[model samples]
Target: MMFKDWLKNKTTQLFFVLWLHISLLNLFFVNKRGIVFLWQNNSELNTLLTHFVTALTATLFYIAIIKIRLRLAEKKLTLGNNVFVFGSAVMLALIGFFLF
Candidate 1:
């Protein structure tokens, strides 16, 4: 696919946004420098491990959101339904935040 068309895709946009969100969360909250610190320190193993964990975490979150979105899309749209989905996403994110 062309880059422009790829960027226009909902799935692509969602993935990009979620990846950026998780990355920022790690940078400011979880790691406080994160990959930069590892790079500066030249800790190859730590850097690779960090990258793997970040990508894994992002993928897990993406899957969770996508599954929830798909399930919700099957039902009639309603404010309550929207709220439930939002709440579920927040709860899942919190679980990841605390667990990690």
Candidate 2:
């Protein structure tokens, strides 16, 4: 309940969405193939592709989360909210690409 309340704030919503995005991508995307690739002399293009996939997954999660939260709140989804969420998601995804 407290956490949900905290998520209602604009900054918290952005941080929560972004952090979840980053953490989920980091947690599940790693695997044996990925490990082997990174361990080998992987090309920059391959590394870039991996980051792209991670960011895409994170962006999808962020959008789904924001939509679900809005639905649960019984609020009518608005254009402004959608735009804000999208922009935030894009920014977070880009940052995640660099960080991961």
Candidate 3:
């Protein structure tokens, strides 16, 4: 398979795993310490908005990392498997933010 095809498949699989794991984490640990939700008072709209903004920012950062990874991959600068690894890490971080 071509490198682009391999990257596409790997990215899809990473996304699936990331979504599944993050969903599970949210279901099991959303209110746990150090999570943003733990500090939020859900009754207020402004507080909810703040949390939304925070989560959005985190997700954007994750996307930026993914973009950088793709650029590195395009340039053949990253080592074997490191691109997927870094992408997965970013997804996990976004998941944490989502859970919060």
TM per candidate comes to 0.41, 0.33, 0.40
Looking at model 1, which ten-residue stretch has the lowest summed lDDT?
Answer: 34-43
Q: TM-score: which is higher, 2 or 3?
A: 3
Q: What is candidate 2's lDDT per residue for 4-91, written digit by digit as tens?
A: 6764565445655665564444444356666322323233566546655655666667668777777867876445678779989998
lDDT of 2 at 53: 66
Worst 10 residues of 3 by lDDT: 23-32
Cα lDDT of model 3 by residue, 1-100, tens digit:
6977986676656555654554444433334464454333444577555545655554565667778878988998866688679978998998899799
Model 1 CA deviation exceeding 4 Å by range: 1-43, 77-100
lDDT of each: 0.62, 0.61, 0.62
Deviation of model 2 at 74, angstroms: 1.2
Candidate 2 positional error at 89, Å: 23
TM-score of 3: 0.40
1-100 per-residue lDDT for model 1 (tens digits) = 7955863475556655765664455443234555442234333567446655666666666668667776778885435678879988999999899899
Question: Ten-residue segment with the worst summed lDDT in candidate 2?
Answer: 35-44
Ranking by TM-score: 1, 3, 2
